[model samples]
Target: MQLLRSIGFFHGNILLFCVTTGAGIFVSPKGVLKYSSLNIAVSLSIWAACAVLTIISALSLAELGTTFPRSGAPYYFLKRSLGSSVAFLSLWIKFFIYPLGIATQSLIISTYIIQPFYTRCPAPELPKKCLALAILWSLGLLNTRGVLTVAWFQTISVLMKITILCFISLTGIVLLGTGKKENVAKFENSFDAELPGASQIAEALLQGLFAYSGTSILINIAGEIKNPGENIPKALITVLPMVAVVYILVNISYLAVLTPQEIISADAVAVTWMDKVRLPFIFGSIAISLFLILTPMIHSPKVEYIYGFIFIFSGLLGYRLHVHLNQRSVCFDKITCYLQLLFNVSPPEDQDEGISTGKKHLEEIFL
Candidate 1:
């Protein structure tokens, strides 16, 4: 069946926002600070620079997406611009990378969630993995329903996450305004201690880039978008800068409450920020709620990994079954045909026709 085209401009924007801003924002600041050697100014500057680079990348990709919007976007673009072989390899690599990336992010979320609850001992890894798996499967099942359901979930969750970040930022402002001046002076003195070298800056910029990694996801689902050409570009331009601003403000908020060193040492920066600001009881509850809301949205893209494996395995099994059946004598040709039809061992004629049409359109636009 053809995919439904129900995602509009607003929904598209929220999907991009949620994907881009996700768990990275809550966790990356600590790595940024560590990479920058606890220099708040340097880390924030890296974040700003990466944001600009991400926007530039999004704009270029947006133009490409508008011109030739399709599912399997990266593979489609590669196949058209380069060749089929390159595209095939890209698809294979993506299949491997998707699961690994999802598992890592899910584990990070679980770790952060349990960190605050740990009193003496550290958070256990077995529970973390179980929690991560639970999140992955839950979201995967949710996505199987329809893209519209996923869009609504993304919209609400992203807004809640943004609100939580804003609340944390405001709390930072309050703390900075009322807290003693000595702490600020001490932080300033440390900021000016020694500038990081080029290598260190580059490493820190990588962390910032990781936080901004999901901007291109809009292109991946372009086939389902209501107005692929108009909505794709609009969402990229509108949501990216907002994501950047939120990232910067969140970092600034972290600095507002704790010194650069404290942020660098923080295991979970957002949780630490709440704890240090002395709002653990109030903001802590809100932050936990935000994370729970954030989980499904962040885990949505990862659902593609599960589907990817299913498609790959099914195709392989069908091909092997077909080959086995083909080896039989000519008298069995009728039976082989029946089995092929029953098991769907070959691609449907209409699907090939649709793919040809899509390729022709892409060629007309690009060639």
Candidate 2:
């Protein structure tokens, strides 16, 4: 069974960059500002600190990923280093967490999409949930085609997102140079304001960390990446710092255009920045939609984890019941097939051989 190694170093790096520096940049600046007692400098500092910490974590995980280079990275790492139960638990937790993240991002996208249309009345909740499911299933199906399709989609979307950010940052820089004294004065005064408490600072850092959370995504699809050993680490090191820089610059852009108080009060900081700059509503909505789309697409590879966990758990339960009833055996071919699908590998030429191999592995752990 051969998996496609279609994702090159460039695509891998861009994917990691997009995933780690997500829609959080659009919303988190406001949260950090508000929670850190409206201190713009402290919020930006926390963002930088978290980016560094995230880079360190990415480096460590890159070593592990390149060494093992498996499709289900966390599962393989834990299974070999600890045991099967720990690996299984990790998959189980990821099953819930990843989908929840996708759903949350989808809902956010739906809200932003409907915001302009529903200005006269409250947007309906059912349509939002429906749109979320639609987006989830559509992306899941797109991923099932092959790794190449997913990689290309991620690369294009990420490039577009970065361009939008660059535009926003440049707009801020231009505005700053042209006598935007009101917000500049407020931003300058903020540097001398009282600093936030340690707990408040910690909370702000956590928010930044959450924004930088997807740096390890390359590891999840290690088997499908071209030259995993070289590309995995290269992508991580290349993208993490770059993403950190983008985050900091974007936050500065937000502060440059709007005062700290304006940012803290903004429901969506990027949109607010756009409004402050008097950009058209259509362009703002497009940027917001792109951010929403890119955020969930970061988790696209994890869709397999959901199916993998279900099949493994069911197989284990069937095995237990067979043992209790003293039956001859519980079939394990289904488990083998599901695992191959989960890893996006073709089935072996000999089905019996594949099932026997899988059954032996499970028997060692469960029997």
Candidate 3:
């Protein structure tokens, strides 16, 4: 019952969106360049492949989720299928690797906020580490509340981030169509300098995998699902494509606006690309990025608390409902027994136990 409460109604789509879109675009460009010389075509191909692998992994996870459909979730599946040591290692890696990535991304996002104001501020500014710690703690507080609100918040943040990207893409398109010297051809020779070699392809693939790492979060909450078999699969099948498209378009927009060298020269993607945009895009990007930075912080603690609270509330709610239902059942049984008595008919055997119990409880209350 507790597990049901914790996992209930959190379908695969919701989880897929949360995990897939979490920190990918914010961090992937750096990862992509470190592996490749930031070749646009190669980067796109690697990212596309990563999305494919994610979908494949998600399908496999769906099978596991449906078969087990319990609270232990992925841990249970891995433990049963692969053995405990492997399962523990996977779980441990998931806890640190992903969350650390998320924490880092938040700091990256927050850096944009601070960077713009660094010189203007009175005493220079606080250290980057301090800002990162603040964001993490703030997010932890928000996530401690529970899952339902966190789900809704994530959906909204993704929309805002996607909308901003769309705006940038559209602006670039308009700039090109109007013959405004959009410089799309500047990077024509981006590959001429040094294209990625075979080893880099493998490395790019790994980085892309890291970018697309959170695809299985829904499976983590499978036990709480109302109908695990149906809902979990439906959500995953529908959500992954949307995430993949957004990721591709956003990265392309980055490349479109600035050449490979331009993207690679800067240390931070948001700061570099944002500075190039018109005021609307610059301020809008800042505003939108700020919102996204807060999104994870807000949702993280809420999700944690939600599942935590469910552990407490499920048993209590179930017990209360059970008692209430049993009481009502007895009342109905007594009324049926009276009708039988009046009609000179024999009442069901079960009526005796129910009526007697209800009578005893009612008498005790009255006394």
On lDDT, the leading prediction is: 1
Error of 2 at 108 (Å): 2.3
Model 1 clashing residue pairs (backbone): none
- Write the residue-wise lDDT of candidate 3 on 1-367 in tens digits: 3654444444345556666765557667767866786666668777888889888998898888789887668899778889999999988887888667877777666666566654333222356668778878877887787766666766677677667657766665654555544556644555565588888888888877876777677667776677888887888778887778777767766776677676766555656666676577577799999897678767675677568668989978866775656535555556655565569676447988867865665565445
Which residue segments of model 2 deviate by more than 4 Å? 118-124, 279-367
Candidate 3 RMSD to the real structure: 26.8
Q: Residues 102-146, candidate 2, lDDT per residue (tens digit)?
A: 676667667656654554454688887888788889889998988
TM-score of each: 0.73, 0.71, 0.67
Tell me the deviation in Å of residue 13 in model 3: 3.3
Choose 1 or 3, whichever is better by lDDT: 1
lDDT of 2 at 19: 74
Model 3, CA-based lDDT:
0.70
Candidate 1 achieves a global lDDT of 0.80
Q: Candidate 2 clashing pairs?
A: none
User: What TM-score would you give candidate 1 relative to the actual structure?
Assistant: 0.73
Top-scoring candidate (TM-score): 1
Worst 10 residues of 3 by lDDT: 117-126
Candidate 1 error regions (>4 Å): 186-191, 280-367
